[model samples]
Target: MSPTIFYGQTGKFTFRMLATVLGGQSICILLGALVARAIAATDQGSGSSTAYLVVGVGLGALCIVAAGLMRRPWGVTLGWVVQALTLLSALVVPMMFVVGLFFLALWVTCLVKGAKVDAEMARREAAAGGSEAGADDDGTADRVDG
Candidate 1:
């Protein structure tokens, strides 16, 4: 796939990576809720199960929208909102705090590293383009016998 469409502008690699991560988080949350319902300790009732399902589905939807929006400037802000919601989920499942924190760290790292990679790629592309332009301007192209 074209990098511009899949990953957004040259300097926004972090946004693309963040979108993928959010999608993953959505699936995990849905699966975890179902698993928790299966476990005896957490088998509350149909009412609780429904609640879990609703939250999971809502989160999944949000992740999908956020992923698609990553190309926009507001995408990062939406990502932060998703992160906060994930952290807030700990109120329902205490263990989620740990999981949420881990993902939070991963999110931060992806943003930092992805931004650096984007910058490096942009720099290389600019250098290459400049060199090609100079060669054409200097009559290097015409000098080639072929």
Candidate 2:
């Protein structure tokens, strides 16, 4: 519930997000290539599908940027946007089910990990302050007794 639990330590979370984005992008690229190949084989004119694949890759790249900017509002927003788009793709193309599932899982992982990372950072900060306060009080206590 605390904000710190969502915005504190972000190193691991950021890394995971980056990995997820990269992985997602790769999947998109691969799928797009396959679609293009299929279209070519059937002479189905897959230009549009190829375009979609390019868009997916672009979105993935944006997500990567977002992961890096996790500390910024833009990063989170862009990441969510990419996630939404990935999910939406499923509605139009059932073939994208596998990619959709993977992206969804990755998104959830980022959310949970992001929160945990922040909580950990906050805890560390608090502990550091507590130690500093304890040390400061130690000298005062001895001085008062003397």
Candidate 3:
């Protein structure tokens, strides 16, 4: 059986970019749980601390897992989903609207810019080595050994 390759080796600018944003989001989600609990203290209608922690940890886990899944094709899709959920989090924490928007913009910018950088790096590598990496069906790069 052929071994599955990992695309991360060929291009990691986007990976690092997304990981930073997602890691920060995960931490924020966890912290938001405390905020939610505090907010609920003053407002009975805001929900319970247990529920907040559960939801917060769940969302935070999603972010962390999404970061780990960056080598897969669907990882980017999952990242987008995380972004949407983060934005939707404003429903629970009003301040999250601004935070979510900021992270969303950062995510988009990072993705776009990171891809360009990776491509440029790949071009440079190919020009220097006179060989190009071929992508596998699973979205990983097949490094050609000269």
lDDT of each: 0.71, 0.58, 0.77
Predicted structure 3: lDDT: 0.77
Q: Encode model 2's per-residue lDDT on 1-146: one tens digit a residue.
A: 53222233345555466456645655574565456445545555444665655665665566566656666645555656666766666554555667766776766676677667756988897987776754554534223554
TM-score of each: 0.76, 0.59, 0.77
lDDT of 3 by residue, 19-132 (tens): 789999898888886787677778776557678778878999999998898767777778888889988988878888787888888887777787789889988877855433
Error of 2 at 18 (Å): 5.8
- Top candidate on lDDT is 3
The 10-residue segment of model 1 with minimum total lDDT is 1-10
TM-score of 3: 0.77
Residue 138 local lDDT, model 3: 66
Which stretches in model 3 have alpha-carbon errors above 4 Å? 1-10, 45-47, 131-146
Model 1 clash pairs are none
